[model samples]
Target: MRCAQFRTALSARLDGEPSGLPEVRLDKHVARCTGCRDWLARAQRLRAQVRTGTADGPSPEWSARLLVRLGEDRTGEQPPGPR
Candidate 1:
């Protein structure tokens, strides 16, 4: 299978979805393909970050701005400008 297919399967696997490809086949391709290996590593890290909500998780300031905007949407008022 091509690298793209492998990468797609890798993403599916990471997402706990069925890849439709055998795990052994995926492992063999990743073992021989440097790009796939790197991709798998990066995908794993990203999955970890997403699961923990800390992959460059939103800053407090950003969260505050979002909250303010949401409140404004409900209240029909403009959000305050940045300080």
Candidate 2:
């Protein structure tokens, strides 16, 4: 498989999304292609960080403010923060 196709499938597999390639094909490509192997490693690391709650996200305060804004919109009330 081409590097681009392999990379795309690698990402999809990591994301638990549907992939067209067989599992054996994906594994074989990663084993033979150093570049694809590195890409898979990086993707796995990032996925691990996300699963461990270390991925970047809005601060608690920011998330609270966003929730308040969403609630206000739903209830047709003015939100507290500057728009």
Candidate 3:
């Protein structure tokens, strides 16, 4: 399956929704795909941030970085920073 498909499944899994795809298949893909793995990590972080509301909201730097990461994701580029 393409990375996009796997990403959709990942989002569903993260949200506790059925992905209609087998868990093993998704796991296998994430295992070897660095881009998807990174995407998943970023998504989890974003979710956590949302759940734990900040007093003043996300910082400008954080927002900008997120936008850049998302743009890179859409273009299939590996985002800069930690793996």
lDDT for 83 (candidate 1) = 55
Model 2 Cα shift for residue 70 (angstroms): 20
User: How would you encode candidate 3's per-residue C-alpha lDDT over 1-83 as one tens digit per residue?
Assistant: 68999999999999999987999999999999999999999999888878887435778778778877666554468777776
lDDT (CA) per prediction: 0.86, 0.86, 0.87
How high is the lDDT of residue 52 in model 1?
Answer: 93
lDDT rank, highest first? 3, 2, 1
Index of the highest-TM-score prediction: 1
Clashes of 1: 0
- Encode model 2's per-residue lDDT on 1-83: one tens digit a residue: 57999899989998889767999999998999999999999899999999999988999878767878576544468777775
Global CA lDDT computed for model 1? 0.86
lDDT of 2 at 60: 80
Error of 2 at 72 (Å): 17
Off by over 4 Å in 3: 55-83
Range of the 10 consecutive residues with the lowest summed lDDT in candidate 1: 69-78
Once fitted onto the true fold, the runs of candidate 1 whose alpha carbons sit more than 4 angstroms away are: 63-76, 79-83
Question: How far does residue 73 in candidate 3 sit from its true spot (Å)?
Answer: 39
Question: Per-residue error at 50 for model 1, in Å?
Answer: 1.1
Q: What is the lDDT of residue 1 in candidate 2?
A: 51
Q: TM-score for every candidate vs. truth? A: 0.73, 0.63, 0.65
